[model samples]
Every structure is written in C-alpha cells, then in structure tokens.
Target: MKQNIHPQNHEVIFYDVNSGYKFLTHSTKTSSETMEWEDGKLYPVIKVEVSSDTHPFYTGRQKFNEKGGRVEQFKKRYNM
Candidate 1:
C-alpha cells in the first residue's frame, strides 16, 4: 500500500550445494554469481546448504536415536 517501500522481487536461481539441485524462483535476495537457466536465460544464482532435494525430513532420511529413557538406561547399567 506504500510507494517504493517493498523490496524488489525478481527471478533468481536457488542452488542446493548438497544435492546439486537448482530451481528458479522469485526472491528479494541478490547475488553476484549468475547461471543460465533451462529457458536459456541468465539469472542470479544463490547457493543454499539445505533444500527439499536433500533435506532429511523431506527426503525421509531422518535418523532417530533410540538410546532409551532414564529407567531403561538404569536397568541396562545395573543388569536388572
């Protein structure tokens, strides 16, 4: 509702470093790096450490540590 109060949004590429995945989306962020997209146009590329491509929760690769509760640990320690 204000004039020139919001940041500019433009097409940018988000690159997942872990999974080597790249996707184009709109964001207010800018980068010095640039990459050519599938549509044959160059866009500002932003590198991200985590994304849906390799995230543990999204990919269903999460690990659960079942070390047991306090009582179970006590029993195991005392051999009871």
Candidate 2:
C-alpha cells in the first residue's frame, strides 16, 4: 500500500432507478451527490437503470418470444 498516492476508499450507494432500491457498498469512485442512509451517514449515490428488484427475470415477468409459433411447427414437422 502506497502512502497518500492511492484514491480514497469510501462508502457508496447504488440506487436502482426503476425500483428506487438503494444499497451500500464500498468503492473508489467519487461523486458529488450524496445521501443519508439508514446508518445515519452520508454516502455517494450512484443511480442505475436496472436492479433485481425491478428486473423482469427476478420479478417473474420475463417474456419469451414465440418465434412465430415455431414450437407447434417443429412438432408438426416431426409428427411428434
């Protein structure tokens, strides 16, 4: 570990834009924006577009394309 040459290690907040979910994590990244978390301390808030809270896969809302009814076509083609 070098002395004073390294960037500061600080707590960061990742905010999910879609779900308004936030969590604390440590990073070397810096930001001007901050938030007071449940621990009663201010941390850098970084906003993200997606998180598991609102993600389709995690929410069980994920959709799959029918591929133009390919399943039926495949069964018919195979006569199975």
Candidate 3:
C-alpha cells in the first residue's frame, strides 16, 4: 500500500439536524466547526440533515399511501 496517500481519519461528531442527536465516529471529512464532546475534548462537528435516528425507514415511520399502491391501482383498473 502507498504510504501517505490516504486521507487521515479523525474522531468526529455528527449532529443530526432534525432529531438533535449526536454521535461519535471516525471519518476522513473535516470541518472548521468544532464541538466539545462528552470527554471534554473538541472534535470536528459535522451537521447532517438526516441520519439513522431521523430517517423514516430506520425509525419505522415511513408511510405509503395504500390507495396509491400499484397493486391497488392494478386491481381497480382490472376490476379484480
């Protein structure tokens, strides 16, 4: 493997915008913004609009219009 070719990964904090949730993870991305973590150390903070905490699929809150489903539409059109 080539040395010094990969971006350095650092401890980062991801803040979910919708849910106000924060988590610690390692990433190659960086930001000028920093925040003090629970350990009292400042880490680069990344703001995200969505994460597992706020995603509809992960939260089990995703809704589909049953009346607009393909199966329902096919059945209605075919008189099934």
Candidate 4:
C-alpha cells in the first residue's frame, strides 16, 4: 500500500434503471452525472440496467422454456 498509488474511493449512488432502486456506496468509478441523495449531499450517479431488486434469479422469476415442451416429453418418456 503506497500513498497516491490508488484511485480515490468516494461515495456514489447506483441507480437501477429497471427496478428504480438507488443505493449509495463507495466506489472508485467516476461519473459526470450527479444526483442529490437523501442526506442532501450531491454525489456521482451511475445508472445500471439491472440490480438485485429486479434481477430474474434474485426475484425468482426465472422461468423454464415452456414452449420447448421438454418437461412434458420427459414425463411421457418416464411414464410419470
């Protein structure tokens, strides 16, 4: 660990575009866009397409391909 060798880590806001969720955390990433947080402090804002709030796997919305009819074929093959 040397001085001035690492980038600055600052608190930034990550906005989820799909879920409309915003959270503040420390990141080295810099953004030109800034937003006023709940604490009345201005911080860099980064927009993300997906987040845990709206991700399919996290929300348990991942669906098997029903159009393939694979489950039906397997059940029929096994007489189940």
Better of 2 and 4 by TM-score: 4
Candidate 2 residue 38 C-alpha distance from true site, Å: 0.3
Residues 1-80 of candidate 2 have per-residue lDDT tens digits of: 76899878888998986667888988898689999999898988988777777678888984333334778868878897
RMSD of each: 11.3, 12.5, 11.2, 11.8
Comparing 1 with 2 on lDDT, the higher-scoring candidate is 1
Each candidate structure's TM-score, on Cα atoms with residue i matched to residue i, is: 0.74, 0.59, 0.73, 0.69
Q: On residues 1-80, what C-alpha lDDT tens digit does candidate 3 reach at each position? A: 78899999999999986677899999999899999999999999999977888778888995333456788879998999
Tens digits of per-residue lDDT for model 1, 1-80: 77999999989999987667999999999899999999999999999978888778888994333548999979998999
What C-alpha lDDT, on a 0 to 100 scale, does residue 14 get in candidate 1? Answer: 99
Please give, for residues 14-33, the per-residue lDDT of candidate 4 as tens digits: 99876679999999996999
Error of 2 at 1 (Å): 8.9
Better of 1 and 3 by TM-score: 1
State each model's CA lDDT, in order: 0.88, 0.80, 0.86, 0.84
Which residue pairs show backbone clashes in model 3? none
* Candidate of highest lDDT: 1
As a whole number from 0 to 100, the lDDT of residue 56 in candidate 1 is: 83
Question: How many steric clashes between backbone atoms does each model show?
Answer: 0, 0, 0, 0
Residue 67 in model 2: shift from native, Å?
A: 27
- Model 1 scores a C-alpha lDDT of 0.88
Rank order (by lDDT, best first):
1, 3, 4, 2
